[model samples]
Target chain A: MTAYALLVEYDGAGLVGWQRQSNGLSVQEAIETAATSLNGGATPLATAAGRTDAGVHAEGQVVHLDLAADLPPARLRAALDFHLRPQRIAIRAACLAPEGWSPRFSAARRHYRFRILNRPAKPALEEGRVWHVPLPLDAAAMHDAAQALLGKHDFSAFRAASCQAEHAIRTLDRLDVTRVGEEVVIHASARSFLHHQIRNLAGTLHMVGLGRRPVSWPRELLEGRDRRRAGQTAPPEGLVFLGVDYDPPLPWVTSDRA
Target chain B: MTAYALLVEYDGAGLVGWQRQSNGLSVQEAIETAATSLNGGATPLATAAGRTDAGVHAEGQVVHLDLAADLPPARLRAALDFHLRPQRIAIRAACLAPEGWSPRFSAARRHYRFRILNRPAKPALEEGRVWHVPLPLDAAAMHDAAQALLGKHDFSAFRAASCQAEHAIRTLDRLDVTRVGEEVVIHASARSFLHHQIRNLAGTLHMVGLGRRPVSWPRELLEGRDRRRAGQTAPPEGLVFLGVDYDPPLPWVTSDRA
Candidate 1:
């Protein structure tokens, strides 16, 4: 069996997110089904860099699946996209994986982006693509407050109750919250996170931005560690998985195999 | 009767253009209904600087309306917006016109903007707001070709067959086409335009960008007075009535009444 790493982009509005669920549609099921169509028999099972919740979007989601076919990685990728097109998920790039390569355990970092529309009016065109908040927000105050929560921390106070992480201790490499025009763009990078960790932090920042919580609130929440002390979780609509990183870029050529 | 000028903004998808249509809803009908609701009496008549076509958006549409009430101009404007909130067309501002103000007759110049989305992938978020053409366009060629048709000329070939203009001779103040990333923004201004003039120009330019026509094609079309000679009219979705001009330096207020 050969392992392949595939990069994917998708519109999450039509999805139940990255995982397969009995309730509705998902990106994973679509890709797996598409891959299975090319392989003739075995249903393709993929492991992603991370499992995102319902309503979350992704521009660069990395996944890997072992195939029992002689078909090339590029051909496999193209075939998968052909079948996945109806599902709104696209396979951007696909290549043979390095020795023992896996999307989940082999990733070194992950990045996420959250967009906030900071206007009194709703988005006329980008309706579901952004979080439309009708109230004015102080960006500087939120940025200053966010700095206190940087570096290593046991972020339980900002962790969701449904979080299944083995430990709450994690290192946050960067958390930049800045405003561009009428929208707020939040960039966050980390090794990994507890369930809804980044989303919960967004909620805390929104609280600080609106002057509901003091600027030093995030640091206090980190130190507090009580689940009930966390700010309300931000909605899933505005959050997106931007990318996943692994050191030593793969030298495999995708087109040659196809 | 006191005449008031109003600056307006609207999402054109819901409008059957600016004129009253027997087939469906029009921007004029929407505004007239709201104007009548703001004050008790009869429905006021509304006229705009330019009667934009169906699916053509506008960020700054200049209009004049006569109200038979003692309502403050600001309150009249705000109340109209409150009642018109259920509709897509919004009254950005309303003010008492400086004596002898007429939306159509007093206008010295008019400007129109046409946006072209040239990308391989469709804009999922901006579906109805833009016109998506997948083919790659040569922006420099389009710009060079556009200059040949600039200046005073009998734009007979560019004017629609049913254009009501008494003469085809009109001086074009400006005709510039530039690129912004994958999109091309065309800016053209004149004292006034013949019906479907800009759309006709855009259609011919599109052919030049695609290398289907020579740089002199736009000039050739303008020199030829036959409507059947020009390229097809561009879709209305990608166009916007950017702004209308009056004698400037009047406090820079966006109020409809200058």
Candidate 2:
């Protein structure tokens, strides 16, 4: 069997997100079904770098799977894309990976972005792609408050109650808040994240941006280690899994295999 | 009655065109209904600078309406926005206009933009906002061919059959094509246009971009003045009415009325 990595993009509006669930269709189930068809009815398990929640989009989600069929990466990508049509998903790129490479564990960093439409009028063009906050937000204040959460710390205050991680300690590489025209943008990067961590952070920062919380509130929440003390979790629609980075980065295969 | 001007934005996915129609709900009818609610049940007429076709979006569509209620511009704007809730439309701005001002007649220029997703994948997030063209396109070739239709001409070749314009002669001010990442953007400007003129021009230019037709084909179509020989009229989903410009410039009232 050959191991392959696929770069995928999807609109998470209607799907049940990145994991396989009994409630509805999921990104994982859809892709595995398409791959199973190409593999002559044998199901191949596809593992993603991030199991994003429902209504959370992805621009460059990475997935890995093993296939018995020895097909060129380009043809595989094209075929998978064809089978995935009429759905809001695309296989952007596919490549052969080094043996035993894992998309979930081989990553060094993961990036995410959250968008807030900071305007009085509701969005017409970007309705579901953004969090509509009718009140004005101070981006600079939010940026200042976000700096308090950097580096290794116990992020229990921001962790979801259902998170499966063993510990709440994680290193946040970056957290930035900025305003571009009428939208407030938040970018975050880390080695990994707990369930609803980024969304919780965004919600807390939103309070600081609105002047309801002091600049030191995020730091206080971290010290308190109480999830209830943190702000409400931001909606999943505004969150996007940007991409992932790997140490000794996987050599992307661009040309067709002979 | 006080004459007022409004800057409006809307998503045209489910609504009819700007004009009132018996078949479906129109943008004009929606705004008029909201305005009439503020004017004590008397339906006010809303005239738009550009009567965009069905599924055509607008970012800054200029509109004029007269109301019997002497309300502040801010209050009027807020009331209309409140009543337009759950609808994919917004009143971006409102101001008192000079008496006798007409959105359709006093306009000096109209601006429009068309978006094409030039990629192999169908859009997930921007599904209805852009035209998905899977083939690779040469933006430079398209831009070069568009220059042929810049000057004044009798554009019978590009005019739609149902167009009610008295004359086919119109001056084209701008037609620019540029590639932005995976999308090809086309911007067109003119004092006025015949029905489906821009879409037809886009369709013709698309052929030139694909090397299906020579760069000189647009000029040849213009000279021939035969509508049947030109390319098909492009879909309305990709077209956007950006805004309009007034010659003397309408003085926008900023302060709230006493």
Q: Which residue pairs does candidate 1 place in steric collision?
A: B5-B256, B5-B257, B6-B256, B7-B256, B95-B257
lDDT of 1 by residue, B1-258 (tens): 677787777778978999889988888888888888554668888899899888988877888788877677767766776677776776655667778767777777888888887754444334566666657778789889888877889999888887888998888888888989758888989888888999899888989988999988888877777889778899888888877787741122322333
lDDT of 1 by residue, A88-127 (tens): 5766667788887778777899999988877544454345
Docking level of model 2: acceptable
> Which structure among the candidates has the greatest DockQ?
2
For candidate 2, write residues B9-81 as lDDT tens digits: 9999999989999999899999999888778899999999999999999998999988999988877877887
Candidate 1 wrong stretches, greater than 4 Å? A1-11, A29-113, A169-174, A177-179, A189-199, A226-232, A240-258, B1-8, B34-36, B62-115, B149-152, B165-194, B225-229, B249-258
Please give me the total number of clashing residue pairs in predicted model 1: 5
lDDT of 2 at B102: 84
Q: Ten-residue segment with the worst summed lDDT in candidate 2 chain A?
A: A249-258
What is the Cα-based lDDT of residue A81 in candidate 1?
Answer: 66
Q: What are the Cα lDDT values of the candidates?
A: 0.79, 0.90
Could you tell me which 10 consecutive residues in candidate 1 chain A have the lowest summed lDDT? A249-258
lDDT score, residue B202, model 2? 91
